[model samples]
Every structure is written in structure tokens, then in C-alpha cells.
Target chain A: MRRRLDMQLDELNELLTHMGELCQVAINKATKALKNGDVSQAKKVQKADMKIDQIEKDIESLCMKMLLEQQPVARDLRQVSAALKMITDMERIGDQTSDIAEIVISENITESMELVELTQMAEAAGKMVKDSVRAYVNQDLSLTRKVIEADDEVDRMFVENKKELVEYIAKDKGKHGERAMDLIMVAKYLERIGDHATNIAEWVEYSITGIRIEGN
Target chain B: MRRRLDMQLDELNELLTHMGELCQVAINKATKALKNGDVSQAKKVQKADMKIDQIEKDIESLCMKMLLEQQPVARDLRQVSAALKMITDMERIGDQTSDIAEIVISENITESMELVELTQMAEAAGKMVKDSVRAYVNQDLSLTRKVIEADDEVDRMFVENKKELVEYIAKDKGKHGERAMDLIMVAKYLERIGDHATNIAEWVEYSITGIRIEGN
Candidate 1:
């Protein structure tokens, strides 16, 4: 029975890693679509979000089953519960990426507007997502901290991007206010994705140390 | 043992009600701060958010304890799991309310701009929160549907509010663009609160019928 439980835990880890990869793909595709003004790619991201949602439901059911069958305790219990928590954040990352794609597509934000800062923000947030999942899969505390610290850079980029967008709107004398707002919303979504990544890292820390970090 | 589990479930319900009340207070205080442009109220909302966060952690720990101690199955297990899912959304509602309050305080939005649509949106969102909690506590499927249906009105108000803000910015020709953006963001937060409420209602429905309603 112990070996079976161990095997189930390993399966859970593998599933979470798979879900994390899908999230990375979703975010990357959404941001790339925005950069290239690829409407089809944006649509593809939206479609992929359904798969992420389905995977979350699958993972949740699996966790419930494990708890029911094994009645896990101590560190095992924490690991299962933490996975339950982590998947919610991962699902939100997928949703936020889809939201970004929706904004990009609806606004018809073609290659006209400069997206240097927003792209950097996306890359930073995407990296955090990838690293946070890696930290969990490997139980790497240092990588978890790195993911947490990366949130600061994502936030700084958001602030800087907001300022630049505001200046652009002012220079256009409100003519491009709508476009500027869309860009700001995109940045905000990216920042939120970074936050969800940080949340996943914090959960990973809790699973490892049995100590919850406050205000990550 | 069954009786003890039932008693613990009762306690969980009471705790959830208390947390829901705190969420209501946070949203009300944040919206009130926006309406009156009262920085102190905004600060108060921010402080109250910490209390909400603390309560969520407490509730989560209690849920874990119940799961570990009782090993509940079937309906009882569903109730506990639903509570676990509901608290995350509730906590997010608090965080988003605090985010709105932060914008209200930092922007120093004085009592100059007309805020009729936003006021309506806040009231609608607040109702959804209250009704969702009531549905969960009472297991009222009809009330859950009511809460879910009300999200449409909140969403419509967001669109209208966005249009009005854009027009207001255009009239000022970017002079008050920053302020306009803040108002739009406030509306967006309210809309998100409504979404979270809808999520709670959906979870309530799941607890009752085991049928997940999509796009509520």
C-alpha cells in the first residue's frame, strides 16, 4: 500500500508538470500572437484554455481519490493538499493568458503599437510559471525563491509600461486612448500571471517546509 | 463518529458565513471609498483585507483538519471540498477589493467625476456576493441560479461604464485620462468580484447536484 501511494504521488507530480507545460504554451502563444498580430494564434490560445480547464478538473478528481483511498497524513497530506491549491493558480494563469489573447484580438492590436515592455513582461511572467512548476517537481527551494523574486521584475515592468502607455495616450490627445487601455490591460494580465506563479511557488514551499510564507 | 463529523461540518458552515461577511464588508468599504473619494476608507479596506486573509488561512487549516480526522466521503466529502474551493474565490474577492481601494487612494480621486454607473455596478456585485453565500449556507439552488444570473447585469454595467469613461476621457482630450483609467479599473474590479461570486454559486450548485454549470 505504501508503494502504491508513492506511485500515486509520482503520478500527481507528473500530471502537474504536464499542466504547467500547457500553461507555458498558452501564455507564450498568446503573447506571440499579440506580437505578430496573429488572430489565428490568439484563437488557438483560447481553444487551449479549455484543455487546461479540463486538466484541472482531472487533477482535482485525482487528488480527491488519493485522499479517499490512502488517507494520507503528515508530509504526504500536505503534498496532496498543496497540489490542490497549486492547480487553481495554474488554471488562473491559463485563464489570464486567454484573457490577454481576447484583448489582443478584440482590439485588433496589430503590429502598429510598440510592445517592447509588454513582451518583456510576458517573458518574465512566463519564466516564473515555468520555474515555479520546476521547483515543485524537483522540490528545489532555491528555484522557488527565484520564482518569487522574479515577480518584482514583472511588477516593475508593469509600472514602467503603464507610464509609457499613459504618455503615449497623452501625446495622442486621447485619440488612441482605447488602444492604450488595451495595452495596459494586457500588462495587468501579465502581472497577474506572475502573481499566480508566485502563489504556486509559495504553495510549493508550504509542501516542503510545512511553513506557509506570508505576503509572497 | 458520524455525529462528530456532522458537528464539524456545522462549524465549517459557520466559519464560511463569517468569511463571506468579511468579504462583503471589504467590498462595501472599497466601493464606498471610491464613491466618496475618501482615502481613509480606502486605507481601512486595505487593513480589513488582512483580517480576511487571516480568516481564509484559518478556514483552510480547519478544512484540512476535518479531512484528516474524519476522512469523510460522498456528500460530506463534497461539502468539505467545496468549502476548500469556495474560500480561494472568497479570498480573491477580498484581494481585488483591496486592489480597487489602492487605486482609489493612490489616484486621490476627488468627488468631482460622476460615478453613477460604477455605484450601480458595486451594488450589483455586492448583491451577488451576499446571495451566493446565502445559497451555499442554505443549499438553495434557486438562489444559486439567481446569483449566477445577476452576473450578466454586472457585466453589462461594466461595458456601459467603460463606454462612459471613454467618452469622458475624449471630452477632456486626455487631460483626465489617468483619472478615467482609474475609474475603468474600478469597474473592472467590481466585475471581477461578480465573477468570483458566480464561481461560488456554481460551487454551491455542484455541492447540491454534482452538476457543474459552465459560464455562470
Candidate 2:
């Protein structure tokens, strides 16, 4: 029974890693679509969101079954519960990526209008997501802390981008103000993705240390 | 054992209801801050968020204790797990409300710039949140569905407000364009609050009926 539980836990970890990879891929595709003016690529990102949702459901049920059957306790139990919480953040990452794709398609966001800070922000946020998942699967507290700290940089980037966008709109309202607003929304979404990554990392900290970071 | 489980479940429900009320109050305070340009009111909203976060910690530990002690299965298990999921959405509602308050404080939003649809949107989102909590506590599938459907109206309000803000920026690029953009952000946050409320209602459905909503 112990071995069985261990195997199931391994499966849970694997599934979460897969979900993380999917989100990273979605973020990449959405960003590339924005860079290349590829509407079809954006559509693919939206379509891929359903798969991410499906994985979330799968992970949720798997966690439930482990609780009902294995009835894990202590550290084992923490791992399962953490997975339950982590999946929600992971799902949100997918949803935000889809939102970005929707904006790309609707606004006809082209390569010319892409803000340099926005792309860098996406890269930072994506890396955070990847590292958060890695920290969870590896139980690496250091990696988790790194991911949490990286959130500040993404937030800084967002503020800087917002400032630039505001100035751009102020200067060229008739030309690209609407598009700048859309980019602001996109930047906001990416910022949110970073937040979700931080949440996931925090959950990993909870699972490992049994202490949630205070004053969140 | 079953009686004890029932008692603990009741406590969980009551705690969640209390959390919901806090979020409702936060929304009210944030919206008032924006309308009144009372930075202190916005500060209150930010300060109150810590209390909400503390309550989330309480609920989380209680759920963990129940899982470890009661070892609930079947519907009782579902109730416990669903509460876990519901609290995340509840916590997000609080966060989004805080975000609105932050915008109000930083942007110095005032009654003069308040869009008609934005106020109405806040009201709709708050109602959905209140009703979603009621649905969860009452196990009322009909109310859950109602709250879920109400989200569409809130979303429509967001889109309408966004369009108006875009036009407002285009019309007055040098004057209040930045404020208009800030209002758009506020509108988006309200829309997200509505989304979180819908998620809570869906979790209610899952707890009551054992069938998760599809294509969310």
C-alpha cells in the first residue's frame, strides 16, 4: 500500500509537470503570435487552453482519489493538498495565456506595435512559471524562493511598460491609442501570470516547510 | 463520527460565508473610494485585505484538520474539497477588490469620471458574489446557475465600459486619457471579480451534483 501510494504521488507530480509545460508552450505560442501577426497561432493557443483545462480536471480527480483511497498523511498528505492548490494557479496561467491570445486576435496586434518590455516581461513570467513547477517537482526550496523574488521584476517591468504606454497614448491617441490600451491589457495579463507563478511557488513552500509565508 | 463531521462542515460553511461577506464589504469600500476620491477609504480596503488573508489561512488549516481527522469520504469529502477550491476564488475576490482600491488611491479616481456602466458593473459583480456564497451554503443549484449566467451581463458591461474608455481617450488625449485608462483597469478588475464569483458558483454545483461544469 505504501508503494502504491508512492507510485500515485509520482504520477501526480508528473501530471503537474506536464501541465506546466503546456502553459509554457501556450505562453510561447501567444508571444510568437503577437510578434509575427499570426492569427492562426493565436487560435492554436486558445484551442490548447482546453487541453490545459482537461489536465487540471485530471489532476484534481487524481488528488481526490489519492485522498479517498491512500488516505495519505503528514508529508504525503501535504503533497497531495499542495497539488490541489497548485493546479488552480496552473489553470489560471493557461487562462491568462488564452486571454493574451484573444487580445492578439481581436486587436490585430502586429509585430510593429509589440512593446519590447512586454516581450521581456513575458519571458520573465514564463521562466518563473517553469521554475515554480520545477521547484515543486524537485521540492527545491531555493528555486521556489527564486521564483517568488522574480515576481518583483515582472511587476517592475509592467509598471515601466504602463508608463511608456500611457505616454504613447498621450502622444498618438488617434494612431495607436486603442492598440496601446490593448497592449496594456496584455501586459497586465502577463503580470497576472507572474502572480500565479508566485502563488504556485508559495504553495510549494507550504508543502515543504508546513508554513505559509505570512502577510501575503 | 458522522455527527462530528457534520458539525465541522457547518463551521466550514459559516467561515466561508463570513469570508464572502468580507469580500462584499471590500468591494463596497473600494467602489466608494473610487467614487468619493477618498484615499483613506482605499487604504482601509488595502488594510482589510490582510484580515481576509488571515481568514483564508484559518479556513485552510481547518480543512486540512478535517481531512486528516474525520477522513470524510463521498459527499462529505466533496464538501471538504470543494471548500478548498471555493476559498481560492474567495481570496481572489478580496485581492481584486484590493487591486481596485489600489487603483483608486494611485489614480485619484473621482466621481466626475465615474462611468455609469462601471458602477453598475460593480453592483452586478458584487451581487453575483453574494449569491454565489448563498448558493454554496444552501446547496441551491438554481442559484448557482443564476450566478453563473449573471456573469455574462457583467462581462458585457466590461466590454461596453472598455469601448467607452477607448473613445474617451481618443476624444481627450491630453486631458483625462490616462484616467480613462485607469477606469478601464478598474472595469477589468470588476469583471475578474465576476469571474471568480462564477467559479465559486461552479464549485457549489460540483459539491451538490457531483458533476463539474464543462467548457468553462
Best by lDDT: 2
Give the alpha carbon lDDT tens digit for every residue of B4-85 in model 2.
Answer: 9899999999999999999999998988888777899999998888788899999999999999999999888988898999
In the predicted model 1, the residue pairs found to clash are none
Please provide, for model 1 over B1-216, each residue's C-alpha lDDT reduced to its tens digit, 9 standing for 90 to 100: 459888898889999999899899888888888878888999999888898889899989999999999998978888888899899889889988988888877675545556778888888998898889889889999999899889989988987876676666656644666777777778878988999999999999888887877742
The C-alpha TM-scores of every prediction are: 0.72, 0.70
Off by over 4 Å in 1: A36-40, A65-77, A105-112, A173-175, B1-24, B35-95, B102-116, B128-156, B163-180, B194-216
Off by over 4 Å in 2: A1-26, A36-99, A102-117, A124-179, A191-216, B108-112
Model 2 collision count: 0
Candidate 2 TM-score, true structure as reference = 0.70
A95-122 in candidate 1: lDDT tens per residue? 8888788776776554455588888888
What DockQ results do all the predictions give, each relative to the true complex? 0.21, 0.25
Q: Ten-residue segment with the worst summed lDDT in candidate 2 chain A?
A: A106-115
Worst 10 residues of 2 chain B by lDDT: B106-115
Report residue A40 deviation for candidate 2 (angstroms).
6.1
